[model samples]
Target: MLFSLLQPALIMKISNIEDIPGHNIVEFYGIVQGSTIRAKHFGKDMLAGFKNIVGGELKGYTELLHESREEASKRMIQQATDLGANAVVNVRFSTSSVAQGAAEILAYGTAVKVVPHD
Candidate 1:
């Protein structure tokens, strides 16, 4: 009874579908999370009168933001998995300002486990 053992691990109850593992999901329910990210500005302040018609890439800032969002999403997923959830659905993403100089990204969805019929 692998599924029985993973009962508590399930987070979502799919009240819609009754089959799972092949795109047809069972009636289970869970929560899924997602995040979005944006680049950051560095110590080098933007000059008041300087404007580039084409936006030059900011490597460090871009990397920092992309990595941060990825880490955050992974953490959320891991949290769900640790709880014994096997699948996540209806995931959505969002972003917001965490501070004056930093932003936060979030990913959310339904976490659940599929139970097969006899």
Candidate 2:
């Protein structure tokens, strides 16, 4: 996996806010985004149907969304890295139903280079 190949220190920072707190953004590399569509398998779908009738949380769907979000974030980070960004700011996520059983997860942010405030 890409994450496995990347050292922790080499991974770009990400934030939902416009700034990186103690750091200053010195360059803007435009917006970067990543997205993925996911759906449950037939067995999980059947289980989800049963859970819906029971009026409870669908664990399978929850896990699927979680994994999708992770993937989307990873892709977004990769794009930022490709642009030579050290951090991403103003990050945001959006979700939309792509089909009856599938949904798309999107991650976006402004890629930037940052330096510690002097």
Candidate 3:
């Protein structure tokens, strides 16, 4: 109820193309990007360290990264929509360690308006 009300109704479409397939780019609004950094809690960090030694996927770290990426992507789309873009093209993602126990995620793309090719 409250969660649904707070959620965005529209999520701008994104693609790894200069223009959407089968569509024409009618406008270009330059580049847009969103980034965030996250770190695991001390307990999760210790658990992850043990998992690393055991050579298994660190579930906590994986979920942290996944959530970070989703947040970044949502922010990027919001920025593009604020620029009056209906879509974001040539989307790209990047990740890097911002600190010993923290990682940064970035989502970037060119904001554009597109319509189906006639």
Candidate 4:
């Protein structure tokens, strides 16, 4: 089910779990990771400040984080593919403030080759 959703955009399967259900991990290529740091522009930052006063969702910041996460995930997947991995297991994400207005998003997982059970 999840595989189908990911198939169009990526060849590598990514899962937070250790296993991929019907597939068996035949080989491991160690850890693969990717990260990106993002900061809102002056205009967006100003808007966010105003929104904070009203105590509402920061849509600008939300979109920025979403883009950062996607970029990081794509990079991680590319690294796994380069290592001859068909999937990434035990995937995880981390976020941290790199500066006052900048945040870093990281994606990491164990690269592995998997084969369907016979």
Candidate 5:
């Protein structure tokens, strides 16, 4: 109820971490988002980007990263919501190597309450 009211289900966008709240949002703990990418994928994207310089749309790779990030972010938010958080603030994102062929993407933010302006 609290979270559903604050973070409306309609505008369920998970993009920038800066758009979120802080760490002290609630007592509940949740991990809404999780992302994993492959280096070979990035490399392929880079190659595709290079080809775009002489051809057409270069949006493929960009879209790939964007979608992955969004998925991760959404998951994170969902996790927090599952824990009964109304909002998440002070979010931060980071990418790291998971293995020789893979990389991990993370989207994190604090879940908190946003009082309505009455």
Candidate 6:
């Protein structure tokens, strides 16, 4: 999978619910998403195999997953911001194995504009 670093132009508030506690959704911009797949490098794969035998945490795999999630989230936030959304609601994440050694991570949500309710 190919991925480039993406920095969100704005900090978009994200939530797992349809609405923010103190704000009301003024407009819905539809869905936004970002996804990426990652496979371990040969060196890391070897290291992980050894660690698996030793029964300890596989730091290389851990880092790969962490970075993948960050990239996916960033891309999602960027999309939402570009659509004039101040927030993304009903945010969700999913992971799947696309291949024997590759894993795909996805982040998605509904982009919406919200205003504080009085």
lDDT of 5 by residue, 11-118 (tens): 433324544332322243444555657454766667776886898765765566677777777677777667666666566788776776456778877555543333
| Per-prediction TM-score | 0.55, 0.92, 0.89, 0.91, 0.55, 0.87
Give lDDT: candidate 1, residue 5.
47
**lDDT tens digits by residue: candidate 2, 15-113:** 999999999999999999999999878998999889978898988889999999989988888888888899999999999998899999999999999
Kindly provide the TM-score of model 6 when superposed on the true structure, using C-alpha atoms: 0.87
| Residue pairs of candidate 3 with colliding backbone atoms | none
> Tens-digit lDDT track for model 3 on 27-47?
999999999999878998889
Q: Please give the distance, in angstroms, between residue 78's alpha carbon in candidate 6 and its true position after superposition.
A: 1.3
**Candidate 3 wrong stretches, greater than 4 Å:** 1-11
Over 4 Å off, model 2: 1-4, 8-10
lDDT for 78 (candidate 6): 84
Clash number for each model = 27, 0, 0, 0, 16, 0
- Residue 18, model 2, lDDT: 93
CA lDDT of each prediction against the hidden true structure:
0.57, 0.90, 0.86, 0.90, 0.60, 0.87
RMSD of each: 7.9, 1.8, 2.2, 4.2, 6.5, 3.9
Whole-model alpha-carbon lDDT for candidate 4: 0.90
Best of the two (2, 3) by TM-score:
2
Measured with C-alpha atoms, the lDDT of residue 16 in candidate 2 is 97
The true-versus-predicted C-alpha distance at residue 83 of model 6, in Å, is 0.9
